[model samples]
Target: MPALEHVQPLEHRSGRTNVPGAHGFLGRLRRRRAQREHEASVICFANALRGMFRDACAGIGLCQYVSVAAGITVRTPRVAEVRLGPPTSFTVELMAGQEPADFTSKDRGPRLAHTLGAHGLRVEPVAGRWVRIHLLDADPLRDGFGLPSLAVATGAESVILGRTEDATTLGHAIADPAHLGVQGQNGSGKSAFCYGLLAQLAAAPDVLVTGSDITGLLLGRAWDGTAHRAHQVVGTQDIAAHAVLLEDLVAEMDRRLETIPPRRDTIRPSPATPIVLVVLEEFPGLLRAADALPKPKRGEGIPVGDRIRTAVLRLLSEGRKAAFRVLMLAQRFEATAVGGGYARDQFALRLSFRVPADSLEMLHGADARPLGQEHANAAPGVAYLSGLGRDCERIRVPYLGEYGEYVDRVQRFGRRAES
Candidate 1:
């Protein structure tokens, strides 16, 4: 893939003049304070947006979509305001419903922005009877994105995967039991997302990392026992080797669930006990290998592939509360590879980094078959973040350096911290 120099800001906003001679000290200071307040306040709809949104919002059924607000205007929705953003992007607030979700539901939302002549869009709740509509002029990921230092990337909330197409908001990865599902065709930068994620993850204290690939190539090169790395990584095509690791994972899941306090939903990382992240590379191939083996019977030894599947399935079903999160990588998202719907649901966050039509459909939905073509051809790490429900938007995973370079940096950062 191509590397991008850090993300260049298109611009914050337009039409601000710096009066060098300004109104004297206090006057100038008051003007600056006003500027700051203006920046912080929500924007008003632009002139051009008035007509576009009026038509688009009505088309999306926002006017007709209303909630139980007793005689609420369910027939003729109005776009109350369009917050002016940068020249290319902005947000709109509609007279929606008591619950924004009612107006921005899957039935009404999925393709509203796409139909509104936007590169991407997101619908969010903004207090009562109001849902915010954000529109982007073009796909932000097409330009490619770069990662910050490990120190910056490790911060749970600020470490950006990439911003929305509009550049209005930054999306970051959450470590709180959001087991991720990453899918894309070969050479589509699926691994880029994984390794990039691992790089940021390594910075968090008490976060245990482990990864595996059938050929022992990618993870082997990136996470081998180095001066600064301490996680266990499995790199082999052998099913038996994978089986052993999976068995241990299942065992740990069982042990932890039994040991953790009853009320907690999942484990939180701390200085002592850490969050465990397991990455499965070429996961579908391994899954198929497991499914091919005959079912294990009483008094008969199970095949390594089957054993591996059992452990993986267990992790998917019951690992969250146990603090075991898995990032499954595969070229396909077929039933045989990713298990049935029940299993797939365990992955709260699903990402499709540059994938083909068939895989894209399976990962997102049938309608998404054509969605990721931009990432597959023009941009590498660009993908649709499917977990955002009806508001699923296109985002680019920031490309950290190649595996070795990233690991080296992680080590160097560790040394600096120690000193």
Candidate 2:
């Protein structure tokens, strides 16, 4: 959570020399050029220090086993060693924007365990273009303890994943499952964040997992070889298939309801079985299509805009007992987008990302008029997650390259349906 400060040059190897008389004329020009170059180098050095500090903070916050100290060691032009407790596997990592090819330096220590550093982390650059640095961990750096794949800590009823500077962003207890809702804009990392949640849920022994998406890409290859055996990527263009799938789900919901015992009115899903997560990407498409019908169910006195509203309300009222949870994604928020009080209350957690100026009223509240005007079009993967007591806070979700690997491995086991 520490911020970068101005770094003064500890030493400068290059300097301009003033010549007298004969070379004086040409010397002035040379001196000017040399001064510029020196200044540029000094800037690079200082900027590198800030980057190293940021990376060290990120590592300490992110890693389960690694604890980085405030100390930083600059070995050369682009090489830095961060002291985070005793060296273990990867005590030192190549900071982002620093390439091994930039300045060549070699060091010996423990055997290298991991060569490919965390990739896809976006960082701003003060000089040149933004770059991603690779993290390396070798034998010399290994501490006696092995790091856990994920280290989650729940304190003060708040959840802290990795390291975060913002206090209210992630440390709150997860609200009731039924009250969770998330909203985000395009490329805001909402999809990726959802994937991470799915992974975490899958790892839990008591939960079942089932998910479907209208767009074939949102779920993508993330669920390739995990515990999920049945996956549905419903295409919006195919209305017939889509309707059939919905009918089946309705029947499934009814079936689950019937299983509730008379004495014990509570409906419980078997822990071994996977629960269904109906992930609708841009669900408005389905609502619009349903409303196109001549005599669709509009609920009692509900207008035509009530199609989605009714559906959402139905899910909220009855879906929970059936072990069906809705994870809906939309690009925008509009009154006509989702119908009635049902749509309004169906999603308890709403997340917003780079939303349109006009949609703020529907997404955030009428009072968000000010924010809507100064809307910060957050970068891809950045979002504001609200709901379950985790109010809207700016966040950047990290992508675990493991998805690609999962896809490759699953495809090897069996061919994926191309169509």
Top candidate by lDDT:
1
Q: lDDT values of the candidates?
A: 0.62, 0.46
What tens-digit string does per-residue lDDT give for candidate 1 at 29-140?
Answer: 6556766677555443355556665566577665674567575543444466555654243334444343455433444544665666665555666665565666656554
Number of the top TM-score candidate: 1
Error of 1 at 47 (Å): 12
Clashing pairs in 1: 43-83, 45-82, 63-77
Clashes of each: 3, 23
Please list the residue runs of candidate 2 whose C-alpha ends up more than 4 Å from where it truly belongs after superposition: 1-175, 203-208, 220-233, 261-265, 272-274, 288-312, 339-341, 366-370, 401-419
